[model samples]
Target chain A: MPVITQRLRVTARLTELARVRQFVHGCALREGLPERETFACELAADEAFVNIVVHAYGGESDGPVFVRCRGVANGLLISFVDEGMAWDPTPPSAPPWESTETEITVGGLGRLIIHRAMDGVRFTRRGNRNILSMCKFRPGFSPAE
Target chain B: MEVKITEYKRVAVVQPVGRVDSNTSAEFEAELRRLVESGRTNLVLDLSKIDFLSSAGLRVIVSTMKSTRKNGGNVCVAAANARAAEVMKLAGLDSVIDMHPSREAAVASF
Candidate 1:
């Protein structure tokens, strides 16, 4: 199948997450990805976009977050680009699972979701732009090992 | 997100509809906190209608759970859709929060 690509640019704000998610879902549907895989891709993209909007700009400047989705080879590739702060993209460790003795706090769940939902993830920095790329392979279409 | 609060077997059941992402999680959190402050300690969040659940939503759940636990109560989850369940499992929330296949089971767990 021919690859289809779609791109969107929005301000680095939390309110823009819904728009981004819609774009991803549209592309996923167009690509004929299964419902479960589409949801996984959407979740991974949401995590990456949220991270960029909340942590990248650092409350100093408002910038645009660019998103690109490509459907190719029975998979989806979603990339997020932002011209905010430059930081490493290492996935954070998940918080302790047992909530018996301590109060559950909020942290590290985004990275965990991103890493777990997407089959492949990569981060790159180039010329003041931070790029996060995630890929989800369709079920029953895995490449030969 | 639209939140509906009802009582089930003495447990406060909070059901949120629509997406619970960064854009809408604050509202969801506020409702949960209000319920906690109203002395409704036990919570069972019905996620069947929620189409999306992001980290922001997870943060609200964790905070609410903590507040309720401090009051000698707890929060449980019920009827999470596939996407919500996947995100919760990825975050290892299944271990931290009690999740039930249905509202009855969640209310019973509490």
Candidate 2:
């Protein structure tokens, strides 16, 4: 099967979250990922994109953000590159999902879920840029149908 | 996501339709809190209309579920499609909350 790869440029705004999701899902579909895997792809994309909008830009404002998806020999690789102030999401930490009501606050839970849903997630500080990547294997076929 | 609240007797069932993402979760947050503040603790979310759910939406549901439980009430989800159901299961919410195949079953769980 031919590998599928694509890139999407989006404004660093929360509204573009859907656009990002569409792009990722489109890539996954071409890669023959299942519906469940497609959902996982969308969820991972949502969390990473939201982190960019909310934290990378400090919710203040930022320039264009680039989301690139490339199908490799084994799976899909999604990279999010932003020009916002550099921050690494490598050291993941968040309150437990089963924590008490007070600890179950809505804050920082997005990243946690992303970590759980994706096979591999990494954050890098390239100069003054923040680059986040998430990878998941192509489970059989069609990530989004 | 689009949220519509329907009143069943004294209970309020919040239905969030479409994919719940960062852009759409605020609407859910507002509507869910509104139902709770209005003393509609006996709540059920009709996920039948929801085709997809993101972590942001899950966060809202989990938080509300915790709050509802603390208030001596409950929040259940009904008729979640495959996409929504998979995420709920991955998040382990399927175990904590009552998930039904239909709204009637979810409402009856209260």
Candidate 3:
């Protein structure tokens, strides 16, 4: 399969969130990803993008966010790059679907959804930019869940 | 978010259409809360029309549920698609509130 990568740069604003989802949805569909898988990627990407706007840029609309969609074997990778405040590269550890027996709160759910929706997620800080990447694979082809 | 609220005898069904994200969650939350303040506390949130559910919207759902419950009211959700349902589950919000498959069922649950 041919590997293709696409990129988009948008201002860090809540209003830009839909455009970001549309960009990724179009790319994921063109890659022939199933609707469910495509939606999962969209949700994961939205969570990451929102975090960039809300946390990285502190809800400011002036900062820039770089979004990328890359095609890989049996899956796709969605990544975000932002020059907002430097954040530690720790992926959230929201418990899996079964063992979560804690009280539900309104806050801190954005990262939890991102960590759970995608097959794998990674974070890194390079120079002054914070990078987050989420990977999702087609069913039956996904490795080890 | 475009909200369509149908008030029943005891409960009201509030169906919000379109994406409920950071940009529109405030309006959505306001609409839901308005119904409560207007003496309609028991509510059924019909999510059949919501295309996307974000954390901002989830927070509104949670806070609304918490607030209403504290006031002897309750919120039930209806017609959430697979992905939306999964998002609620991931947030651990689904287990706390009532969930039904259809708007009528949810309203009748009151």
Candidate 4:
């Protein structure tokens, strides 16, 4: 089937997380994605949206987060666009599971989860906008393999 | 999100109902940390009631799992409805954390 895409605009607030998840899930369902893939897509979308809501707009006020859900020829494509701070989430580092005895506190692990869940992830800065596109390939339903 | 804590056999079970999103994510993290700092490391999070989960929530789970694991204890998940379980699974956390079908099952695993 050809690619089908859906678009939405969400505010930079945490409350919108549910709405965003719901929107993505709805689109995935309409695109005939399997139950497992649908859930994964929702979560991956949630992570991307949360990053925009929390880090974008300097964490001060609300802004716009543009979301797109599409069924690509190979898999699914979800794009999150925002005019917030540009940050690259892809890094060659694993999550810190190191044993720390002297009490330790660390954050910034959400990006790691996002990077590992989706099949493809990219960050692009165009003018004043930050666009993040993520792709998830259907398991055991590969046309290329 | 609504967070409810229940104690069963010396373990504190946190049941966070509803969606764990941006606005309520911090509150969930705070509650989990409070329990961990107070030495209530034997935690079983009942996610069956949670309809939705975001990365913010996943981060809290990962961090808590690390903290409790380091302290010779661990946080488990009891009864995550399909959706919540899928979120945990997608993040590759299903292998990292202990997940069971019921609170009793989770406690038994510990």
| Predictions: Cα RMSD each | 2.4, 3.7, 3.3, 3.3
lDDT of 3 by residue, A18-39 (tens): 8999999998898889998888
Docking level for model 4: acceptable
Comparing 1 with 3 on DockQ, the higher-scoring candidate is 1
Q: What is the C-alpha lDDT of each candidate?
A: 0.83, 0.79, 0.81, 0.78
Runs of candidate 1 with Cα error greater than 4 angstroms are A59-61, A96-107
Docking class of 1: medium
Candidate 4: pairs in clash:
A14-B23
For this target, which candidate reaches the highest DockQ against the unseen true structure?
1
Descending-lDDT candidate ranking: 1, 3, 2, 4
Quote the B-chain TM-score, candidate 4.
0.94
Residue B22 CA error for candidate 2 (Å)? 1.4
| TM-score, B chain alone, candidates in order | 0.96, 0.94, 0.95, 0.94
True lDDT of residue A98, candidate 3: 32
Cα TM-score of candidate 1: 0.91
Q: What value does the lDDT take at residue A132 in candidate 1?
A: 91
**Which scores greater on lDDT, model 2 or model 3?**
3
lDDT-better candidate, 2 vs 4: 2
User: Model 4 misses residue B102 by how many Å?
Assistant: 3.1
Candidate 4, residues A27-136, lDDT tens digits: the string is: 87777778877777887787787667666665634678999988865678899999898866664375444534323222245576577667788999999999999887
Where in model 3 is the C-alpha error above 4 Å?
A: A88-107
True contacts kept of each: 0.71, 0.44, 0.50, 0.41
Off by over 4 Å in 2: A1-4, A88-95, A98-107, A140-145
The two-chain DockQ for each candidate, comma-separated, is: 0.62, 0.52, 0.45, 0.43
